[model samples]
Target chain A: MIGRQSILEADVDTTGINSLRNGPDDNGRFGIFGGRFVAETLMPLILDLEAHYRAAQKDPAFKAELNDLSVHYAGRPSPLYFAERLTKHLGGAQVWFKREELNHTGSHKINNCLGQILLAKRMGKTRVIAETGAGQHGVATATVCAKFELPCTIFMGATDVERQMPNVLRMKMLGAEVRPVTAGAGTLKDAMNEALRDWVTNVDSTYYLIGTAAGPHPYPEMVRDFQSVIGSEIKSQFAEAQGKLPDAVVACVGGGSNAIGTFHAFLDDADVKLYGAEAGGHGVDVENGHAASMTGGRPGVLHGNRTYLLQDKDGQILEGHSISAGLDYPGVGPEHAFLHDSKRVTYAPITDDEALEAFQLCTRLEGIIPALESAHGLAQLMKVAPTMGKDQSIVLCLSGRGDKDVESVGKYLGLL
Target chain B: MTTRIDTRFAALKAEGRPALVTYVMAGDPDLATGQAILEALPQAGADIIELGMPFSDPMADGVAIQLAGQRSLAAGQTLRGVLGMVEDFRRKDETTPIVLMGYYNPVYSFGVEAFVKAAKAAGADGLIIVDLPPEEDEELCLPAMAAGLNFIRLTTPTTDDKRLPAVLKNSSGFVYYVSMTGVTGAVIKSRGAVGEAVDRIKSHTNLPVAVGFGIKTAEDAAEIGKHADGIVVGSVLVDAVARSLKDGKATDQTVGAVRDLVAEIFSGVKRARG
Candidate 1:
C-alpha cells in the first residue's frame, strides 16, 4: 500500500541481521526497549490483537481498504513543498517540507487512525477508546471512528483539556466523549494511564486506539507501518522533484510516532541522516523540567513498554514539562530508544523558547503555521540547516497545521 | 525451596480455612502510620500481607489504590523505603508472609537483581509484580525465583485454559486468580463464576489459588473464600486508611481502621466453609 511494496516483502530483512527497520523482534522488543509489560488481565487481549493485526497485515483486502481510505478519505500524498524562503532565510541547505499538515484533520495522525480503526472494524470491536495530549490524535481518532460509525471515547488530561480546548471541541463535534483525567500533573502520561485502566476494565468489547508508536509490542510496529507512508512518500516524491535523496530528515518526537514514521523508510539509507527533536521544557539539565526522555532520562517501564522515561532515581515516573502539550509525555517509543542506543538516529532536545521562535519564524517565512509539536522539528532544522552546504537538502515532516495552537501561542506571546 | 508464602498457604490449607490476605500501601498517608498498619495486620487476623510498593503510575489499579499510591508517594515512599518497612516488619513478626505488590518500574528502577536480593534479605516472602506476565519471565520472575522468592502470577478471567499452562509454567508460590477481568476495587460481577474459575485453575496446578480484585466487603470475602484458597482484599483497606486521614495526615485511627476491616474480613473468611 505504501511505496509499491507489500508490508511483508518490502521491509523484510530476510537475514534478520542488520535492518534497522526490522525491529521489535518476535517478543515485541526493540532491542530490549519494547515488550508487553502489562498485567495478565490484558495479556490475552493483547495477544488477540496481535493475532488480528498479523492477519490484517497479510490480507490484501485489509491493505486495499486502508489504501482506499487513505487516498480518498484522508487525502494521501501530501505535497512535498520546497521551502524556498525558509531555505533562503537559513542561508545554507535547501529546506523541503513533507506537508503532512495538508492531510485531512490537519495532521499525520489521521494516517494511523485510519489504519487502526479499520483493524478494529475487522476485529469486530464494538467500541473505541484512545488517549490524547494535544487532542490531535483524539480528533483524528474521533474522525475515523465517526466515519466507521464506532462509538468512541477519548481520555485527555484535564490540563490539556483546558489548554487544547479547540481540539477538544473538534473531537466532540466528531462525536467522541472526551473524559478529562486529572491524575498526575494532568498530562499525556496520566491520560495514557487512565486509558490503559479503561482498556483493562472494558477488555471484551473495547479496542484501545493507542495514539503513539509506543505501548506494548505490535503497536510500535503497527504504527510505524501505518505512518511509514510519510517516509515512503518522501522517498518517491523527493526522487521525482530533486532526482536524489535528501541529505537529512527531521521530525519532532513526543511519543515519537511521526518521527518514527518519517525515519523508518530512511533507516537503511546510510547517506540520509535522521534527527528527532524532543521537548526540552526549560532545560534537560533541570531535573524534572523537560520531556526529553533520551536526553535526560533512563530506560524504565511505564504504559505497557520499556523505553526512555523521565523518571527519578527511585524509578518513580516524573511528570514531564513541555510548553507544547502534545510533547509533554515522559517516555518515547521503544524504537526511538533502540535508535538512540544504536546511534542510528540523532535525537536532541529543543527547548520551549527555541520551538516558539521557530514557530513564529516558519509562520512568517514559509507562510506555513506549524503545530507546536512540528515546530520542535523546525527548531532543530534551524540549527542544522545553517551548517550544511547550500546544495544539500533537509526534509522535515511538518506533522500538523498550527491552527489548533494559535490560541495557546497568542496567550504565550501576550497577544491575549 | 519452600518460601514463607508456601509455608503459610500450606498451613492455611492444613487448617481447612482460606487465608485472609490484606494489602496496605507501604507508606500510605504517612510513614509511621503505614508502618503501624503493617505491624497491626498479623495481629488482626491477616494471614498473608501484600505490601504495596507505591509507584507513581499504577495502570492496573482503580481510583482507590491509585489515590493511595499518590498519598504514599506524596508522603515520600520509595523502593528503598518499602524494603526498610519490610525489614522493620520482620523485626516484629516472622510468620506472616509479605508479598510486595505494585507495578514494575519502581522495582526495575531499583535494579532487578539488587531489588530481588534486597527484597529477599528484607523478608519479603514473594512478589506480585502486576506488569510482568509469563512472556517476560526472564526479566524478574526467574531471577526472583532463583533467589528463593515466590513469583506469584495473576490469572484473569480472560486467561483461557489453552494459555493457562504458559501463564503457570514459571509461576511459583501461588496462582492469583483475579476474580474478574478488571482493575482493583470494582465490584465482582458474578460470585459463581469465580468458583468455577478457581476450580478450572486448580485443575492445572497444585499451587494454592488466591482470588482477589473486588473482595471488598465481608460477605464478598465469605462468598469468594468458599472457593479460593486465599481471599485477597486491598482497596477497601486502603480506602479505610484514606477515610481515617485528617487533613491528609494520618489520624490516630488510621492503623486501626485497616486493622478493623481486616478483622471483619477475617470473620467472613472464618465463616466461609462453616
Candidate 2:
C-alpha cells in the first residue's frame, strides 16, 4: 500500500516541488517522445506561452486563483463513488468511479479549459480559440469563454459537426462561433489544423485554448497540470474510501487528458498500475479499425508534439476512426507515449463492440450512463477485473457523462 | 560547385533583376502532364523551380495546394513518383534550378540518407521542408547541405530579429520569405510589408530572399519584385492547373496556362530594376 497522504494538495502543487511525475524536460521532451515539432511561425508564440506558464508556475496567486476556481466555480473535489453493483457484477476487483462526468461541463475537459482560459485572461488575451472532436472540449471552452465574456471561436471537423449536433448548438448558444474544418478526413486532426492556422494568423491577440493534453509544449504540460486534480482527488478519495491507494487506475485515452489527470499522481507509486484504454473501434485492424496509437501507430510528429501517431509509411497522418468521436483522434498525448515507452503505463485497446456492451452493462446494473469515451475504460474493467484477485481494487476515471453520446450510440447499436 | 539555386540567384543578381521561382505540385493531374509542365517551366521564364512532393497531410498548405496534393495523391503519387518526375525533367534541359518542397514525413519515410542520395542523383538542387524548423535542422537540413543540396529556409513575418540567426544559421541556397503569417495561397496583404520583411531578412543574411505565398498577378509580382530578390507565385499557378483540368485530367491548357502566368510573372519581375 502507498503512503496515506492528502491526495489533492500533494501533487496538484504546480511547483513540481515534490512530485513523482517529472517530465517534459527543458525542451518539452518526454524521453524523446514529446518535442515542439510545429511550423516555425508558431515558435515565437509557443515560446511566449511557455514563459508565461513558467511565470505562472512560480506565482502563488496564480495557483491560489486556479485552486479557488477549481473548488468554487468548476465544482472540483469530484466524488469518488464506490460502484457496488459494478464490483459485484464483475465478481473481481472492487470498482470505483472518479466522477469527473459530474463536473460542470459533464466531462473532465472543463478542468483544462478552466485552467487555460484563466491563463489566457492572465495573458491579457481578449479572444480564445479551440478545437474539438466530439465537442466536449468545445462546450467547455465555450462555457468558460461565456463566463469570461471573451469572444470565442471553435474549429470542429465537418463530419463531427454533423454527428455531434447538440454540442455544436451548445457552443453557438454559448456565443461561440463554430467553424467547420473540411480538410483532410474532416476529423479532429483537420480541426486542429484549422485552429493552428487561426492561431498563426491571430497570434498577437488570440489565445489557443487547446482542449487536450496534447499540442506544443506548455500545452501538454499545462493541460496535464490543470487536469491533475483528477488524479490528486483520486489519490485522496480512494484513500478515504478504501483506506489506501487503489491497486490500479484505468481511464480512456484520446488526446489522454483524463487518463493523464488520473495517472499523474500514481506515476511514482510502483505498487499501483496505470492502464490506459485506447479506442479500438473494430479491433485495431489499422486498415479500418480504431485509434489505438501505441498499439497501431509509430512515433511521429503531428499538431506540434512528436508522439505516437497513426500515420502512413511515408509519415502522412492517417485519419483514425472510432464509434466514439472523442476517442477517434489519430495522435495521443506525448506523455502517454513517454509512459508507454517507460513501461509506467500499460495501454490496451477496447473495441467498439466491447465498449457498447460495457455501456449497456453499467447503465442497467448501476443506473449510470457512461460516455462512450469512458465506456472504453469500463470495457477494460470488464476484461481485467474478473481475472484479478477479489481483494484488489480498480478506479475507473469516469471521464464524461453519456448524454452527448446517446444519439451516436443508438445509431451504432441500430436503435436509432 | 555552386548549387543550381545559387547559380540562378547569382545570374539574376548579375542581370540586375529579381528571380522568378515557380512552384507546382508534381503529378498534380498526372505524372506525364506534370513532367510536361516541368520541362516547359524554364523556357517560359522561370529562373528556378520548386517541385512539390505531395503528401496526404500537408499542414502548411492552403486550399489550392492542398487540393493539388490531394489530386496528386489520388492519382497515386508517391515519393518515388515525384522524384521520377524530376529525373524525367532532367533528361533534356538542366539549367533551371529544381527544388523539392513539402513536409518532412515523406523524406523521413523514404529514409533521409537514401532520399538525399536519390534526390541528388535525380538532379534536384534544393529543398524547402516546411515543417522542419530551425530546432530540427539536424534532422534533414545539415544532412542535405552535406549532400550538396541547398536546404532553403522560410522566414515568415513572425520570424523576429532574435530568431533570425538560428533560422539562417544552417540555411543554404536562398531564403524563402513567406509574405504572410497564414498558410500558402493567402493573399499578400501589403507589398510594402513584403518589401520591409524581405529587407529585414536581407539585412540579416546575404542570401537572396525569394518572396512567396500570395503574389497573385503580374502586377502583384512587379510590386513585390521591387523589394524582393525573387518573386514566387505558387497557389495561383496550382489553381491555374486546377482550373485547366478537364474531368480531373490535365487538358492542353495545363502547360500553356502555367507558362502564360510564369511568362507574365517573369516579365513583371524583370521590370523590378532592370
Candidate 3:
C-alpha cells in the first residue's frame, strides 16, 4: 500500500493551475488538454488565444465579472448536503453530497463552459464551438453561448444525437447548430475529431469550448482549474460543517473533469482520500462494456497528452460502452494520468449494474434522483462507506440531476 | 538480396557519423509530389526515408500529422498507393532504407500476412506502427519479421529498465526513442535531455538508436546526433511540404525546402562528429 505521504512528495506538479484565461501556450496546453496540435494555419489563432487568455486572467474586471456570474447566474457555492438516510442505511460512514445538480444547466460542466465562454467574449471571439456526448456539455455550452448572445456550433456523435435527442433539441432551442458527426464509431471520440476539424477550419472568430478535462495539454489543466471550484467549495464547506476535511472525496470520471475539479483542492491534503469512479458498463470486457480506462487501460498518448485509453494492441481506440451517456469515453485527462501514476488518487470502476443499484438506492433512500453518470460516485460510497465508522466523513459529487435520464431509465426498467 | 539492418549499422559505424532519417507523408498534396519528395530525400543527405502510410485516424500524431493523414486520405492514398511510391523510389535509389510508418488498423484491415508480403514485395525495408508496443509484439511484429521485414520499436522516456529488454528483444531495425514524455511535434528547448535518454537506451541495446519527436531545427538534430546513431525529422519536413503546396507549384519547391533542411542538419551532424 503506497502511502499518501509518499505520493504528495513526488516530483510531478500538483499545484492547482494558477489562472483560468491562459490558453494553450500559457499552461503548455488548452484547459490542460488543449495545445497547438494543428497546422501552422491555426498557430496564429492559437497564439492570439494564448495572449488574450493571459490578459483576461490578469484583468481584475474579467475575474470579477466571471465570479459575479458564477454566483448570480450559474449559482455558485452549491450546497454540500449530508445524506442522513443514506448514512443510516449504510450503517458506517456519514456520506455528504455536493449538489452540482442544482447549478444553472446542471452538472459540473457548467463551471468550465461559463469560464471559457467568458474568456471567449473577452477575446472578441463571436462564435463558440463545442463537442458533446450525452449532450450535457452541448446543452451547457449552448445555454451559456445563448446567454452571451454568441453564435454556437455543437458537434455531436450521430449515435449520441439519436440517444440524447432531448439535449440535441435543447441546443437547437438555444439557437445553436448541432452537427451530427457520422464518422468513426459515431460516439464522443468521433464528435471530438469533427469539432477539432471545425476549429481548424474556423479558427478565426471561433472559440472551441472543450467539454471534459481531457484533450491535449492546456485543456486538462485549464478545465481542471475552472472546475476546481468544486474542490475549493468542498474544502470550505466540509471544514465549516465537520471542522475537518472528509475522509474520502469521490466523483465519477469520464474525461475526469468533475473528478479532477472535485479532487484538485484536496491533492495537497495528505490525509484526505481521493477516489475516481470509472464507468464499468456491463462487465470488465473491454469490448463489451465500461469506460474504466484507468482500471482497464495502459498509458498511451491519445487526443494529445499521454493518458489511459481503451485501445487495442495496435493503438486503435475501442468504442467504450457505458449505461451512462456522459461516461462513455475511451480516454481520460492527462492530469488524472499524473495523479494515477503518482498514486495520489485511487481510480476504481463501478459496473452499470452497480451504478443502477446505487441510483435506485439514492432515489428510494435519500429522495434524490441522480444522473446515471453521478450514480457511479454514489456506488463507490456504497462500497467504501460501510467499512468506515459513522463518524468518518465522505464527500461525493452529485454531478447532475436525473431529469434528462428519466426516459432512458424508464426504458431500461421496461416501464416506458 | 538479404541486407541485414545490422550490416548497414556496421558500415555506418566505420564512417563515424550519425544517420539522417527523413519522414514524409505519402500522397500529401498528391502522389506525384510524394514520389518526388521520396526521390529527393537521399540527395538531401537522408540515409533513411520513413514514408507515412496515412490512415483515417492517427491517434499518436498531432494536428500537423493528422492533417497530413487527412490530405493523403483525401487524395485517395491507400497502403497500396504508398507501396507503389516506395516501389518507384527503389527504382532510382536502392541504398537508402525505406520504412513504412503509420497506425496498424489499415494494415490489419489489409490482412497482416498479405500486407507484410506486399510491403516486402514493394521494396519497403522496415515497419514502425506507432500503436504497436512491445508487450503485444506477436500480432504484427513477429509476422512482419517472419516475412523478412525489420520491426522497429519506439521506446519512450517512461519505458523503464524492466521494459527495455522486451522492447529490444525482437526489434531488428533501429530503435526509435521518443525524445520526450508527451506526444509528437512538441518543441524542446534543447536536445540535452534527449541526448541523455539516448545514452540510457544505448546502455541496454546494441541496435542503432534514432532520436525523434521535437527535433525541429538543424541544431537540435546535430546536438541529438552527438549521442544517437540517427536523428529523425518529421513534423518540420511535413510542414515544408505543406508550405510548398501553399503556392500553386508543388514541385521542386517542397522537395527543395526538405533538401535544404536536411543539408543544414547533415552539416550539424558532421560538425558534431568531427
Give the number of the best model, judged by DockQ. Answer: 1
TM-score of each: 0.98, 0.96, 0.64
User: Clash pairs of candidate 1?
Assistant: none
Ranking by TM-score: 1, 2, 3
Q: Which ten residues in a row have the lowest lDDT in candidate 1 chain B?
A: B250-259
The two-chain DockQ for each candidate, comma-separated, is: 0.92, 0.62, 0.05
* lDDT over C-alpha atoms for residue B184 of model 3: 60
TM-score between model 2 and native: 0.96
Per residue, candidate 2 scores C-alpha lDDT tens digits across B15-57 of 8888988999998778788888888899998888999999776
| Residue range with the least summed lDDT across 10 consecutive positions in model 3 chain B | B1-10
Clashes of each: 0, 0, 24
Model 2 RMSD vs true structure: 2.8
Regions of candidate 1 where Cα sits further than 4 Å from its true position? A1-16
Instruction: Please give the RMSD to the true structure for each candidate, in Å.
Output: 1.7, 2.8, 13.0
Error of 2 at A319 (Å): 1.2
Candidate 1 residue B103 C-alpha distance from true site, Å:
1.3
- Ranking the candidates on DockQ from highest down gives 1, 2, 3
For model 3 chain A, the run of ten residues with the poorest summed lDDT: A1-10
